[model samples]
Structures are given as C-alpha cells and as structure tokens.
Target: MERFTSGAHEFLIPMVFYSLFCLVLTVNVAGAVSIQDDCHERRCNNHEPPVRFPFRLQDQQPPHCGYPHPGFQLSCSENKQTLLKLPRSMKLLVKRIDYDARWINLYDPSRCLWRQLLDLNLSTFPFVDEIEPAASYTLLNCSSQDEALYKGNRVDCLSTSASQIIAFRSDGYAYLDNLLNCSMIGNISAPISPYFFRFRLKWNKPDCGDCEAQGKGCRLKTNSTEDQTECFYIPKHRISVRERLMIAGIVLGSLILAMIFIAVGWRYYSEKKKKEGLLKIEMFLEDYRAFKPSRYSFADVKRITNHFKDKLGQGGYGTVFKGRLSTDILVAVKVLNNFKGNGEEFINEVGSMGRIHHVNVARLVGFCADGYDRALVYEYLPNESLEKFIFAARGKDRSLSWERLHDIALGVAKGIEYLHQGCEQRILHFDIKPHNILLDHNFTPKISDFGLAKLCSKDQSSISMTTARGTMGYIAPEVLSRNFGNVSYKSDVYSFGMLLLEMVGGRKNIDDTVENTSQVYFPEWAYNCLDKGEELGIRIEDEEQTETAKKLTIVGLWCIQWYPVDRPSMKDVVQMLEGDLHVLTMPPNPFASTDPTKMGATIPRKPVNRELPTIPEIE
Candidate 1:
C-alpha cells in the first residue's frame, strides 16, 4: 500500500508542474500580442494629442518606435515623465509637439541661470538630429554684455533680458563640452512648471561634421557656425526593459502633444512677423517724408545720365556723371559705390540743404536710395572747382579778373560767416579746402560737401575733437596741440588763411623736396619777401591784378596768426577784404623762423632773455 501511494504522488507532482509552466507561457504570449496590436492599428485619441513620427509608446511599440536613428531614444521617467535623449549631450524634457509645424516645445533646465542653455553645449544630444534651418530657439535674459560664442568665434547677442529666437537651416545637434568650457553653477532650486523655460525646436539638416567630430556645438540657430551638419557624441549604455518601455511610452505621448502646440505657435509667430515687417516699412516711409527729395527711379536715373555714359569725376565715395535732365537743364549725378557704407552722409546733406537757403551753398536737386545703390543729383555748373583755377600753371595770367576774385572771396567769407551766425546753430567747416569749394558760371565761390561739417551752439565756443579734421597741411596748429586751448570757429579761419595763401602763391603752402633745402612755407616766404626789400614779384598784367594779389597776401597773413585771438573773424575778414589796402598791417610771422641746423629748438624767435607772451584761450 505504501509503494502504491509513493508512485501516485510522483506522477501527480510532475503533471501539476507541467500544467503551471504552460499557463505562464500562454500569458506571456498574449501580453506581447496585445501590446503589438495596440501599436499597429490604434488611432491616437484627439483628447490626448496625437503622437508623430520618431516617437512611439512602448505599449503600442514598433521596431522603429522612438526613432530610426541608432542614438535617438525617448523614455518615461518617474511618474510617467517624458524625456528625449539626443545624439550628443542634449536631453530635453518633452512637453508638446506639433506634427503640422514639425516642432517641439522643450523645457530648458538651464533657463533660470545667468548663462544660456545653448551656450552650455546643449546641442550634444543625438535626438535633435532633425532640427531645420527655420528652426529657432528663444533665449531668455540675454543682455548687451552677454555675447554668444559659437565654436570659438563670438556671435552678436540680439537682445538683453528678452527672449531671442534664433533660426537655423540645418541640424545643430552635437556634443561641444569637450571642445569648450560649459561648466556653470546651476540653480537647481528654481521653480519648475508646465512652461518653465520652454523653447521651440524645428527640424534642421546636419551640416557641420568637423565641428561635431571635434565636439563643438553651435551657439545660435543661424549660419553663425562654420559648419551646420555637426553633432555631439554621447557614450552608449544598456538600458533595462522596464526603464526602456516606460521611457518610450512617455516620449511618444509627449512628441504627439508637442506637434499640436508647435503648429498653433508657428501660425501666430508668422502673423506677428508679417505685422512687424509692415510697421518697419511704415516707419521708414514716415522718416523719409520729412525731407521731400525729388525721387528718381533706377530707369529714370539711367535715362537722365545717358545710361551713366558720361563720367564727371570719381571721389572716395563714388563717381559723378554729367547728365542732361531737360532742355537747358543739366545735372551732375553722383553714383555712390555700394561698399561705401556712409548712409549718414546722405542724410546729413539732405537734411542740412533742405532746411537751408544759401546762395553760396550747392543745391541738391534730387537723390536715389535704391537697394545697394545711392546717387545724388545736383545742378551742373559750367565752371569746375576753385582748385582748377587757383592751382593752374601761370595761374595769375589765366586767373579770374581782380573784380571776380574779390567777389568770390567776399562770397566765400559771407558763406562762412552765415554758417557761424546766420543759422540757429553754428556750423563749423571742419574741412575747408580748395577741393570743397565749387565755382559757378560767374566765378562765384560756393561751399560744397558738408560731410565733415559740425553743427554746434553759438554759446559753446569750443568743441571736443579726438583727431584733426581737414587736409594735413591746412589743419590748424591748435587742432593738433592740446596746449592750444580748445578748437573753435577760429580753427576754420586758420584753414581759410592757408587756402588764401595757396590762392595767392598758386601753389601748396608747404611743399617738401630735396632741392628746396630751406623749408619755404608760403606764409613765411611772403612774410620774408615783404620784410626784405625784394620785388614783391607781384606779377600783375593789370593794375587790378597787382592790387588784388597784394591785398590777398596781407589778408592771408592776418587770418593765419599764431593764436586764435590774433586771427580775425569771418565778419572782420570780409570787411578787411572789402576795405582799402592801407588799413592792413604787416602781420607777425606765424611759424617762428627755426633754423634746421639748431638742435632741439623749442623756443620761438624773440629776445633770448625775455619771456614770450602767453597765448589766449579760444572763445
């Protein structure tokens, strides 16, 4: 009976164990089939946002669920939290995605800190391999002092303390911490919310391989980086089944939600951008309306200037073309070089001339400010510039008659005086030279090119200048010397004196040559000639010529005194030019006679024992 009981127990035990193993196998198969079926045909519920490509829940899993790319993976953290792991160092907490807009809103962990997230080499994640050129991320709390460095070069920080959106053409995912120092003290205690430091990411093509290989990341979304296909490298590791399944489900769910959000956000952003563009156009139009410039289209300008066929002259800014606008109406059109980036000059000339009505100043008839092209149209004067007449060979013989010279001098003086007192503000002709003075049909002198003109107040006698303005030889000594008080309107007077000296001598004031061992400055030469009983060589065919030359020389000496106080004002200069010659005095030598042989000569020519009089301050 005992043997029979033992036999039954062994048989029953074996059958029971086998039955339990089969039940467990059946359950496992059913579970795998259910999960696979759910993923294959399940339609995402509208109530819970739809999941897009590159993302899928583990419950409805497919082989290419999270991403087809090897390094891309999405996972659910504690409490079904979604996290996206990119190729490099980028790890984004998935929020919502918009399939239509092809964008995802992500929580930036470094947003609460003083530094930037991208600046911290956040582009290292492998999952961000699909960011687009139009894709941009908004930076928060950026300031003027805060500059962005992409790779090794610094990039312009668009805003300070405002969310800055940057767009790129290709994928920027890559690890850069190995190449750059991205270490920062993070504010881990900062508040976290649904929208805590969220930034949008659009799909972009990868372009910077070297940078990615070198482990450097892009700072901005634009083409600021040298290459765009670069991505950061991340170490691979095995993940557990539970962790992988949970993460995949969360990532898929989050990706679906992100697509919906991105679509709505993109539509709003596009509309806002359109409105901003319109506003900018409106503002530009309003600013342009203040000065009513005769507008000329490109075709009209080409026609007026005979297809820019006739060249007048080329300058630092552009080339001037002579054109016939109408019957008996000729114009000089200056076609500015596109590379000469001086829009302020255009604005200054237009604004100053539009408000001023001076006979001695050139008139602006029209202008063109087309894309990459600028042109200025002025009434063409038959007579060229004053330099052509003054610096000619045997200038006195071919010179303007004494009557015309006198009239031109007076006109120039009047123009200068008007700039000093006629207008509400005092205008200083910083660059007063023969080249800037134009001539009319009647040989009348008219001031042109106010590019270097400085408008100051009458009460403010002096203005601060970092560097000397005007032609080198014509620049006043006071402008270069800090000991000579501050520069004022008298500085222009000094320049004018140099110009007058050139006019009288028919040559430059200072000419250095190996033959002329003795420095023959025109002012000093004239002074010495007058001091010595030599033929003033006053080459004058007519009595008018002799008188005009003598008068101009004497007046030129008086204007170019050593000190500003000694020099006469433009008003006094005009009066002196119009007055009789007998009233003019033999002015003192401007540059004290310095023997080149003397070593370290600092003292002026006077009594060795007596002290020179102190120079007065400029008014």
Candidate 2:
C-alpha cells in the first residue's frame, strides 16, 4: 500500500503541473470572452443596458454592427427612448429588453393599438407574446347596432372607428352570435390585455448565450428557419439536425486528434529527457556511434584511480589522478569537482576533446559521467608540465635547453593551430599557459586543460565573450579592450607570445616577491632589453641556443603587439620558428610605453574586468 501510494504520488506531480497549465489557458480564454461580452453590461444611457455588439446604437457603432434580422433590430428614438420597429407602419416603445431571458416588454406610442389589432398579425416577426404565447383574440368590424347581438361577457368594445365601424374583441371562446358581416382577419399574438396598448414578446431567435458558452461567435441570419428563426452562429446553408450532428462530430474528432498528437509529443519528449538524465547515459552510446569510447562506471573510475591515491594535480575545475588501464597503459583521470556549480568542465572536455584527433593535442581516452560523479580520461603525460621547467629554482639542473624549449613552442603552436583550423569546428582554448602544456615520455609537448574551451565554426574568424578568461599575464590586449580588436585566434596568439617570453625569462611575468615593481612586469623589461640591442639576461650555454632565443624573442614581441591584427597566426609563428634569425627584424614597441628609457615604469598587473551582457546558459 505504501509503494502504491508513492507511485501514485510521483504520477500526480506531472498531472498537477499539466492541470495548472490547462487551468491558466482556460482562465485566459474566459477572461478574453468576458472582455468582449462585457459590452453587454454597458448601457446606452445610465438607465439602460449598454447597446451590445449584435444591437449597436446608430451613432455609437459602425455599419456592420448588430444582427441582420429585421425584427430583432432596435433604434433609439429622438426623445431618447429605445424603440423596436415592426412592419405595417407600427413601432413598439421598448420598456425593457431582458438580454438574459431573451424577452422584451413593448409599449405602443398611440393608445389606438386596439384599432390596429385586426391589422397587427405579427406572424412575420421573430417574436411571440410571452404572456399568452400563441394566444389570439378574434375581432369584429361591424356597425354599433350589431354589437348587441354579441354576448356581453365575451365581447369588449375597443373603440368606434371614424367610419362608424365599431371594433370588438372575441376572446378565445365560441361566439356563435356573430353575424356573417364580421370578417375573421387573423390571430393576435396574445390574449386581450386590459390596458390594450402594451404587451410582452419572447424572441424566437437562436440561443446566443448558450452558443457563446460553447465558445462560438453569434450573429443573425436574414433567411430564417425553425432552429435559426432569426439569429444564429454562422448560419448554415442547411440547418438540419443531421447537418448539426455531422458538424459536432467533426469538431469533436478534430479535438480528439489534437489531444492525441499532444499526448504523443509529450510522451516522446519526456522519454527522451528521461534517457538523458539517467546515470547510465544511453545518449552518449550514440555520441560516437561508430567510434564509441570505453564506458566506465563511477566504481570503475574510483577503483582505477585507487580512490584518488596518486594525485597528479588540482586546478579550478578538478583534480587529476594518475590511473593504470587494463593493458598496463597509464592514463590521467580528471575527476571533476561536483560542488563546482554543475559540472561544465566535464561537458567542455567531452564536447571539445572528444571530437578531434591530433599529434600535438591530448587524446580523450574515455569519460565517466555517472550522475554526481563525473570525470574525463586522457592519455597520461609522464614529464609533468613545462611550468616546472620554465620557473625552475636557481641552479636547478631540470631547466629545459633552448633547443628543447623551441621545439616545445613549435609543438604547442601546432596544437593551437590544429584546434583553430584542422578540426571540423574551431576550438578556442581561452586559457593557454605553460602550466596547461603537458609533456609525454618522448618529451613531445601536448596541449591539455580544455575547461575554458569554446567551439565555433571554422569559417568564423572571431568570437564574442562576456567575461575575461585565461591568466592575467597571458591574456591578450584585445580580450581586455574592444578598442584593440575583436577577441579571435589572434587572442590565443597573443597569449602564446606571453608564454614564449615567460619561457625565455625563466620566471612569471609578475613576480610579486621581487621588491622593484618595474622588474616585476617582465613583458616591459623584456621589451626594453630587446630594444637597446642588449643581451637578454638568460644564462645561454651555446651560440645555437643564443640564436634560437633571439629569434623567439623577436617573434614573441611581434605576437604580443597591442592590436590583434598586428599579431601573427600560429602557423606564421611556426614558420618564423623554422626560419633563420637574420630574416626577422625587431617588432615595434608592443607595450606603447611613453618612454622606453624609463625602465622603472610599472606595468599594470591586473586584467581589466568588464561586465558582460546577459545570456542564457546552454546545458
């Protein structure tokens, strides 16, 4: 019973949401109808109900306003009285038109209504008397002397005509005393009234209120029938019971068909989303349909990493743990931090690195996206990273030789170039520094850490970004200022230049531990040294290393130019690396310092933090 109740509770949640949606829709529809029919509540004058759409007041509405039925129409008189006009030179002073009841009380302007009684056969009108429905009063037009032949109780003398022809009413009774001189004109709409000048009328019009209740617009038909006596909602060519049934069936069938489609679509969407949300994702089973990766469970990841025993490194995104595969092959398992505002890094790695295969780039072996536990698997790099070598302690034997650093730079450049052009989609690695460059057993550099990578079309030259990305020293001038240029592949080039200078300097761009702020901003100091044809303060071992360092410095300066357009492409940088030192000239002052002589000038260390426009996050 508890299980059944729980299952029922789960089902009721969706039902509740759906019911709320439908209720909102229904309320909106009702509100719209109320707004339209609200005019029915409006009075032409303070004392009367408003002239409704089907019966618009002449001056108040357009020509198309009101019903088409001749008898159903009403007009305001010169004296501000509402009047209902009828045929045969007659008009009824409208006392009140009960729109709800579909009943009308009428008054005759002239009290000589009894005289016109014989002439007033209202069979052609759309109304019959509500007081005595279909009741008729028989009248006789005879001389006053002949009135004595009639019984006193059955007859009432109306009035004596100008021609001395007396009119009298023969109430619903067998008055056999009537002479052959009386002509039976027609049936009266109702019984004889004591007042004789006023009566009530019930419209034989179609039920407009009921039609509106069924969500239909109402109008009048000039051509009348039993069902559509005068007014109707879309008057049919033939208003038969069979026709009505067929129409009703068609509407009902269409509604049912629409409901079926909605149900099917909702079910399909729900099932698709459910499959995506499951721990064992069936979605990625097709993510690389032909080239599927080895799937791993959360337990498998934890076991392979030995419960994160051999930690490789940790960053803003996650911690990397060294793991050994079944084939005794080493792998780097980046176990993403679950608490970090939804695991976007996992998606970035899988979405970006999953698609490409290149010699210079890191390979994504597999992934583990088990609900809360998410991790990325990559080919392990044994030599740690270039950062350890770039910023090695003084007299450390571990520093990379200039020849090796140049090759590493070339490899890194190639990786970035491949990311920009070789892939099906252009991948912009927003965060690129020595720390992100991993070296394999062969000392071949492979670019890693795609946490801040963004994919765009290869045809697109530039990308728009909301917030600043990458380390402060390595970020491009264009990235910091739109005035410099648009953030593009050139931005990456600029970062690479900064990395190159840092590699040569053998320290970070901003060394906060240093006392002097001028020497702290390394880019400016490097520029000043290169400008004066002075030897860069690096302990060069040989001429080849010296030549390689000089060529790299010139290229780095060229790449770090303030404008994105001024920077060389990664391919160009690679070509410059392979080219001779004599072929390259000293690039212009990229820092745009007012005085190159002022070596004491301090460079700004902070990246300009600009506010980005609002955008929705893509799951």
Writing each residue's lDDT as its tens digit, candidate 2 over 508-582 gives: 877756565556667677777778878777779888888988888888888887777678888899899889999
State the lDDT of candidate 1 residue by residue for 250-317, as single tens digits: 45645654574576457657767998999979876764574345867677889999999999777665
What's each prediction's TM-score?
0.47, 0.49
lDDT of each: 0.60, 0.70
User: What is residue 251's positional error in candidate 2, in angstroms?
Assistant: 80
State the number of backbone clashes in model 1.
53
Which 10-residue window of candidate 2 scores lowest in summed lDDT?
610-619
Error of 1 at 116 (Å): 92
* Global local distance difference test of model 2: 0.70
lDDT of 1: 0.60
**Per-residue error (Å), model 2, residue 233:** 99
Off by over 4 Å in 2: 1-292, 338-349, 512-518, 594-619
